[model samples]
Target: MAPNKDNLFGSKKEASLVKSNQLDSTVKEILASEQMNRERKTARLRELRLEKEALQPPPEPKAKAKRKTTKAQE
Candidate 1:
């Protein structure tokens, strides 16, 4: 039987395609996990800030000071 050149070369291409697909999936999963972690951290920080604000008293408003006017001619 004659050797099939198509099968011989096709196997290499198939292997590379499979490897690239796996890498793509892995990269996607990593990105998704990082995004989730960032969102979770942001939510936690927001919650902490709210809790801190709730524990603190509201700041008193400052009164405006009157400026002294000096009369030079009038």
Candidate 2:
């Protein structure tokens, strides 16, 4: 009989650990990609807004009306 017989439960545990590690790495990668995508979208929106503003003409200044002064009677 061989003294170093492979245990089934030990192999299963090792496989489970490997799978968990892979899942964790995959989750991290997905989250990082999502963050990058959000940043890119935000930058694109900001650029569009700036471009639109540049294309529009500036608003004209409003003219102020002169008010008549009234004399107070003593």
Candidate 3:
């Protein structure tokens, strides 16, 4: 007998539901590791940001000109 619409679509629907559940669990497992890595990267980024914020511009030095001393002038 040829498959009816319900048999075909029903199986497809069940399959998609099972696949979605599996995908959700897999995603949760992957997120565990990714969460740790993300936390570490975020902490490093925070430290770098704080370091950048703490930095100050250096003070400018004064420009000095050379003076010519002559005994005739004195």
Candidate 4:
């Protein structure tokens, strides 16, 4: 039996034929997935901000105090 030429040089023609279609599909899928991730992240940040606002405590008013005066001896 003779040695196969496809194995020696790594079959450039066959590789190109299969990968041409695959590259476009993979790129489209990745862009769509990244868009979804960005939307999800934005939603999550908004939810967290709302939750933090709800959890905060309200400010309290300050009280006034009276001072005492000392008398002088003659």
- Whose TM-score is higher: candidate 1's or candidate 2's? 1
The model with the greatest TM-score is 1
- Give TM per candidate: 0.71, 0.62, 0.40, 0.45
Rate residue 38 of model 4 by lDDT.
100
Model 2 agreement with the true structure over 1-74: per-residue lDDT tens digits: 44453453457678899999999999999999999999999999999999999999998999998999999999
Which lDDT values do the candidates have, in the order given? 0.93, 0.90, 0.89, 0.88
Cα RMSD of predicted structure 4:
9.3
Q: Which candidate's lDDT is highest?
A: 1
The digit string of per-residue lDDT tens for model 1 on 20-68 reads 9999999999999999999999999999999999999999999999999
* Candidate 1 pairs with clashing backbones: none
Compared with the true structure, what per-residue lDDT tens digits does model 4 show for residues 1-74?
A: 46688776659888897798799899999999999999999999999999998898865776767777778878
lDDT of 3 by residue, 1-74 (tens): 68998776777778899999999999999999999999999999999988887796656797898899878864
- Residue 45, candidate 2: Cα error in Å is 1.0
Question: Cα miss at 34, model 4 (Å)?
Answer: 1.0
RMSD of each: 3.1, 4.6, 9.6, 9.3
* Candidate 3 wrongly placed segments (more than 4 Å): 1-25, 57-74
